[model samples]
Target: MKKQLTAIFISLLFFQLSISAVEPMKPQEFKADIIIYGGTSAAITAAVQATRMKKTVIIVSPDRHLGGLSASGLGFTDTGNKGVIGGLAREFYHRVYLHYQDKQSWPWQQQTEYGNKGQGTPAIDGTDRTMWIFEPHVAEQIMEDFVKENTLKIYRDELLNRESGVLMKNGNILAITTLSGKKFIGKVFIDTTYEGDLMAAAKVSYHVGREANTTYGENWNGVQTLVFQHQHHFATKIDPYKIPGDKKSGLLAGISNETPSPNGTADDKLQAYCFRMCLTNVPENRVAFPKPDRYNLLDYELLVRVFNSGWKALFNKYDPLPNRKTDTNNHGPFSTDYIGMNYDYPEASYQRRKEIIAAHENYQKGLMYFMATDPRIPKDLQQQLNTWGLAKDEFKDNGNWPHQIYVREARRMIGAFVMSENEVLGKKEVPKPIGMGSYSLDSHHTQRYVTPEGYVQNEGDIGVKAPKPYGISYNAIVPKITECKNLLVPICISSSHIAYGSVRMEPVFMILGESAATAASLAIDNRTAVQEVNYNQLKTLLLKQKQTLNWNGKP
Candidate 1:
């Protein structure tokens, strides 16, 4: 009987050990020729190009969903000069065209009902077989289809262990371990995240915030409180004090009490961030904007004052998308952009970043709720806002809200050649052209401060147009040879603040992403560092892939 009891106890212990082994997660080990460390549109294009070049690639993304801003609420694509977008970037838009061609793709509205209304151009380019604008879900589906068709390996919800994630050997990244203990080993790596997290972890040289105008000989680089080119500025003088005229009553919330920075000087303040909300007017497909859990009326007292002071351009940027939806963005002085609240985001811990993201969501949602329901708002404006609601079919997993917030600018790699405003404005020639960017050098407000006259004013809003489609050099996307040998930074390419404003567009990012992957493939073939890749050979391959390296004056 004693022997039998001992046998039973041993059997139970073995069973318990087996169960524990299965329950606890072990570090997943993966190896590939190339590792792309972001889920942005640029990352997707890079992975696709690598696959096309017949190289093994894996995407380790911090995001649960793929396609960063493209899959987010930025459905109104910002394609500056359509002719300049090519290669896999153009292919992605062509796929969007194909998706819309099918009648089954339109569920909420008919194809005919939604006419061509894009960013000052037709939505569909029949000759090129590309569509510039699309719904959020459609973009997500296209990216998923790319992964399925190519059979690419993707690890989602995996964040980089920023402290000790990157393992380097002689300036080459050998492996990167995630917070979850997943280890990804690769021959070549690409950092395509908006925040340049992987690049920063790899000890690559980068810059954060706006550089001085004199730093790169650019006029739109630093503080611009005096230049109010857009209508987002204050139309009338309004008191910045909480008690209307009494300075002793203290400043109102969200208004900075500090003096403006001297123009043409560097500052650490980053551009504001906001959600490009996907809204719809269709009753069946609309979800009313929910009142955020931490909603506070006092937070928006300034906006109420703005409305009372004759600011009526609330719906200036409700850009249309397919299926009766709108890509609503920050418009007037106080809108979606959470001003002066994201200065620490670029270097914040993951937990802290999550809190910031939540705060932005809450603030924007509360703003929408205030505009639609608050009694202080003008009745006409309130009625107009009431017509729009979150698209029910979009972002189903995230309570009918966008899963990713718009990170307009983040850590920019200080690479071999830093593209500045001169290059973008066609005043300087770029060597070994790989891509092009033609968007206006645009920036949103950085802070709201009280003018010397005691009136509230916004600072750091500038929009200077690029002269034409300008070449982005190969050196811009590559790190310095001394910093890292095998890494490429496409999304956060080396550029001054003013030049980055034009290059930060989604199409431009995708274009550079494809170019970066091409360079990576060439480096792998030659067994050389990414910085040493032959520009002539790289240019040949890029042209063969149908990438537009120059404008060619087609229009």
Candidate 2:
């Protein structure tokens, strides 16, 4: 008994000592051939492709989950055409397929009886391919497997020091200091954040809002009052005013009440933002939405008003992923979108980012809690919502809440090539194809405004189908031929804002990520800048990797 007590006491002491030994954000240095800054689908693709090329790679992500939205709960991929998906990105969905081969994976669907709805490049449910729609944790597990098999090094929760921290020497990044003061050294770097935080820190030129239509000769660019997509049209077509016909009631919670005049003028505003909530009806895996501490009922006054306006189609955008869970997102006006509220997020600091996150959480939680329990909602809609809850098996951390919020649109870098509407609509072909996108140019719920009659209306949610599988440009991944010369990119970093609207699909990002990795490796081998890398050589390499080139390339 005495010996056991001594052992237990010594164990406790060791545990405490080990815990104390962890220095508070030490500036440790490490070397790698490539240093990827995010756990996004593109980042993973880059890292995996680099490993295949025998280049040492590491992913330094501030978050623990990998594959960004792909792994974070966006299993219902927003791909426009599956034909454009290929290489590592397609392989990912194949792995997702393998996971479902086991009967145990289908807790809701009967094994061998479930209908397969496979489409796109990987055909999410094809016999030889893995399914695309997946739970958050399953995506994480796949990423972990990829990392483990390739011996890819990943440092989780390593935050970037947004200012004066990432040290670039002679046009090439030498070292980056994280917020915790850890230093990471690499030959080449890729910025994969939805916010482009690291790229901005590196002094890359980027735009934050929709450009006026004249900026890129883009017909669909800027001030798109005439072409709203999706289904978030305001019910009353309210005018942006405060007093109704009297024009005296202060403008509602949203609306840049005054429309900006410059056709292509840039602004510090973006589309909409929402948490990709993971929900389930399985009793064993359901977690009730927790009403946050600062739950202001008044913040949702517009939503309450919206509900009262008879717009109670609650299941409009509850998109399902794998594992009987859903990547439930915002739909019509007054839905889950936090419009006109995230204008400052692109350039905000950590504390500021947290503030926005908290505010969004409050807005979303209150919205859900309202839908499920609010007395004002229609009886049938409320009853339907009551059947849903956060999936117990997904996002096991953070109370099953999705770790990623859809940024929709943010800072887009003007790179070696800027993709425009012409390239997207195939009015003209993009010169160098590195990737493809097929999702309709989809943005979601931006605002609510007061009408001429004192009623409210919604705006900004758009969803336009493209003509075909449009090729994404390789130059979109690199800084201007005159700007930083050693970088390669894929995470919605290149292209004009409207062009990015269609190019920002997850499968496309993964394809671009693989292509970016290929370019980065080639640049390293040839001792040349990313902009100077031979396109023909890059194209050949991509073709070898099963990437569809020229759109007409054979499968």
Candidate 3:
């Protein structure tokens, strides 16, 4: 009986092993020549460029949507000097122009009736056949078209397993695993993420918040407690206490009590973030602002005070888009920006980041609901706001809210080279020119604090204009050889806070993305590390691809 029992046990064990052998393995690992992360415009452009170079590439995207802010209701393109835009960045705008040529593209309005106005420039450049301003859905469709045309494989909603996902050997990443156990193996990696998650995961050097002005010898790199270049600051002194001047009443919802450091000092604070809301006046295509479930009347009490102080620029940033829509951004003090609420967002865990994003959404939506329905607001302002509602046709997936939040700034890699205000202002010679940026060195409010005079005020609203277009260094996107050999960061390039202010535009991100991929493909062909890629050959390829490397034209 013992022998028979033993024989039966051995047979059952073999049967189980055979069953396991036939069972399907955990989903096959995705392998490609290049693995591009992030779902921003830069990721799409990089994937397209890699494919054009005849390399197998895949986009491992955390976002389901394609375009970042471009498709997230920033219809008013911030093209400071449109002449400097080239390569796939210019191609994107050309496609936008092509899209508008079709009368069917204008669903809510006629093509002839659509105004060609943009931010201080014509939205449609007839001479170049490029359209700068575009609706959110239009931008998304164009990005999708690029993917479909290139036949690029994109794994959507795949979150990187930041803790232990990166497999490396001798400073080279072998593969990256996502939270769902999906593995992506690649020869080269491009981190186009706004938060630089992959770059941080690879143990690369990076800096969060701002550097001291002395760190990079930049005048605008650090704390600007009194610098109010923009109109985002309060027009008049207002009490910061909940009970208006009662010291024991405590500070209001958004005001901070910490005495700000001296001007030009470094701090671990970030520029404010807000959703570039797409609102429309069309009754049929408008959804009234829905008050959040946890709405608090006191949250916007400061805004009410602003209104009572004769502030009238509430709608200054209600920039127009096609189809009678508006790309509503943060306007005057206490508008859409959730100031000082996102200080930890750059390094926050995924769960924590989501909560932060949710908080921002709630704050912004609540602000709008308050403006449109609250009796404390001026009647004329409320009436004007009531006429506009969320665009019904835009962002249908998330209650017509933009899928992306404007991450004005984030983790910046301290890579092989650092671009600074010197390069942006054409004060220093940039090396290994890859692309150009002409946007102003702009930063939104970073803190809302009580002034020494015992009044509420906003700080760190900077907008120093770039004198002319300047080259972005190839080394700025490359990591040090010892840190990591295979990763490239385009969106969060190596730059001081002041320089990144100029580099952190959507068009410029796309430009850097294309250039990074071109260099990546060359590196793969030569079997060399990204840092060792030949600059002459890279420059040849970039120019052939029509990237504007140097600018001799007027700004």
**Count of steric clashes across candidates, in order:** 0, 21, 0
| lDDT (tens digit, per residue) of candidate 3 on 124-156 | 888899999888999999999999999989999
Return the lDDT, model 3, position 543. Answer: 94
* lDDT tens per residue, model 2, 1-555: 999999999999999888878845357898888888988878888899999998988888888878788777677677566666789987887887788777777887554544444334443545446475666777778888888888888888888988777888777778888877778898888887777877788887888877777778876666555345665766644434433445566655555465443444555568888888888877777788777777766565566556666777679777656555677877776777788789899888888989998888788888898777778778888888888898887776677777887777778887777888778888887878877776666666444554345455554555667877788888888887565767666775678777788888888888888999999899889988888889999999999998876666433
Name the candidate, 2 or 3, with the larger lDDT value. 3
The lowest-lDDT stretch of 10 consecutive residues in candidate 2 is 114-123
Q: Candidate 3 clashing pairs?
A: none
Q: Rate the local accuracy (lDDT) of all candidates.
A: 0.91, 0.75, 0.92
In terms of lDDT, model 3 sits at: 0.92
Which portions of model 2 miss their true places by more than 4 Å? Answer: 1-26, 112-114, 117-124, 237-266, 451-455, 553-555
Name the candidate, 2 or 3, with the larger TM-score value: 3
Give residue 470's error in model 3 in angstroms: 0.6
Q: Please, what are the lDDT tens digits per residue for candidate 1 over residues 1-555?
A: 999999999999999999988898667889999999999999999999999999999999999899999999898998888888888888899999999999998888999998887784589888888998999999999889989999989999899999999999999999999999999999999998999999999889999999998898888888888678777878789788889999999988788888988987889888899999999999999899899988999889999999989889888899989889999989988889999999999999999999999999999999999888989999998998898999999999999899899999989999999999999999899998999888888888888899887799998888888879999999999899998999999999999987888899999888988899999999999999999999999999999999998889864
Go through the candidates in order and give the C-alpha RMSD of each one to the true structure: 2.1, 4.9, 3.7
Q: Highest TM-score, which number?
A: 1
Best by lDDT: 3
TM-score of candidate 2 relative to the true fold: 0.90
